[model samples]
Target: MKNSLKLVLAVVLCVFLAGVAGFADEYILGIGFTIFMYIALAQSWVVLSGLTGYISLGHVVFFGSGAYVFILIWGLVPVWLGVFCSGIVVGLVSLIVGYPVLRVRGPYFVILSFGLAELVKNLVLINEARMYVSMRPVFGAPALYQLYTAMLLLAIIATGLTYWIRRSRFGAGLRSIREDEEAAETIGVPVAKLKLLAFAISGVIPAMVGAIFIMRSGIFQSGDAFTPIVSFTMVTMAIIGGSDDAPGPFLGVVFLVLLQELLWVNWPEVYMIILGILLLGFVLFIPNGIYGWLSEKYFGNKKNVT
Candidate 1:
């Protein structure tokens, strides 16, 4: 009951924000769109990494692939259909890659994932150069509004899925794998399958977000599409928000997006340094993240006592 109420309230708040953005100036709507994009990415990261405790440094592989695919195919179909197809393509790719990569564990898995993104980026660069591929510009307020709505819906779906998973048997299996894969396997959890499923689920939304991003920006380049910074940003948001809880990534997105808009805009030169300082502070003082800390301080102790 309480969980449902929280979800309802969250959805209402998101809708209210969207309504405000619809009437506000273009700048405000742009900011809202960016926030929604980050939220979608962060929630997607939380789906696999947070629940399964598998840190992927190359998740942007899916994102870039989706963007490139959308750019290649959008002219042949409706933009929305193109974005959906891009997600499907990424999901299939995840399944193909997950089988082999998911077999590895620990730093090996992280390194392999990171390496995959770099490999993909290079391949994209080479392919684009060889084919002379370029995306045509997109314009108009209607397109921007479409991008905004797509992002908002994607963010809601990603977070809602995370919440559902957190309370389901599948979520429990993932949690078990996170705690100890060997033990989970011994206890009859299908660790491999669960991980792959989680990976596929996690990949799809980010890919869709990538498609929306490229559509809105009206351009795509391998360097920009496969930027390692995006991977880091998503991971940081999930970690800083509370990887163990569904609401953590949302909180992280809100806090960091606001911080970026307010402070990074003013001191763009030292933005990364500022972000590093904030991350370090969180790691040192509140390692479990803001949500985790709040949960522990307020609800955890009370539950224990009762």
Candidate 2:
């Protein structure tokens, strides 16, 4: 009952933010959109990496694929339909990729995931060059509003799904796999299937968000779509906020987005350096992240209170 109320309040808050964006200055709306976008992306990353303890350096593969797929199909269908289809396609891709890749554990899995993303990016670049693929920049108030609302919805869905998984039997299985994969399997956790399912679920939202984001931006490029920086940013957000907790990624996104905006405005040249220092400090001192630290300090155990 408490969780349900929290979810309801969150939804109401997002809707209220949307309503405010409708009347706010374009700059403010843009900031809101960026924040929501990162929240969705970070949460999606957390779904698999946080829950299953598989760090994927190439999760941007789905994001880029969705953006490209949306561009490919947008002209033939409604924009909304195109975005949905893009997510389905990306989720299917994750299932196929996860089957073989999930067999490898630890750093090898992370490296393979990164390789796959690079491969996808190269393929996209080659295709764009060969076919002269290009998109005209989209603009206007209506497009912005649509993008903002879609992003907000994606964030909400991702957060709700994380909350559900954290409390479900399936979530417990994933947590076990994270702690000890072989032990999980020995205990009949069906590690392989659960990991793949989690991976697929993690893929879908980011893909949908990518499609919506590209549509809003009005232009798409292979480089931007497949950038490893995005994947890194999501991972950083999840880690910095507390990857073990459902609310960690969201909190991390909120802090990072605001920090980024401030840095970009005042110290763009040194922002990356500052970010690196902060990340290093977190790794050395608060490895479990802010959420984990706070939970330990106040509640003793996040699972109990959450």
- Judge candidate 2 against the unseen true structure and give its global Cα lDDT, from 0 to 1: 0.85
Q: Looking at model 2, how many pairs of residues clash? A: 1
Highest lDDT, which number?
A: 2
Residue 247 in model 2: shift from native, Å? 0.8
Looking at candidate 2, the ten consecutive residues that score lowest on lDDT are: 134-143
- Which tens-of-lDDT digit does each residue in 201-287 have in candidate 2? 999988988888887677888889889998999999988998876788988889998999999999999999999999999999988
Candidate 1 C-alpha lDDT tens digits along 64-163: 9999888788678877898999999999988998999898888888899899999999998988888877434544314576678788888888888887
Per-model TM values vs. the true structure: 0.94, 0.94
Worst 10 residues of 1 by lDDT: 134-143
Let me know the TM-score candidate 2 reaches against the reference structure: 0.94
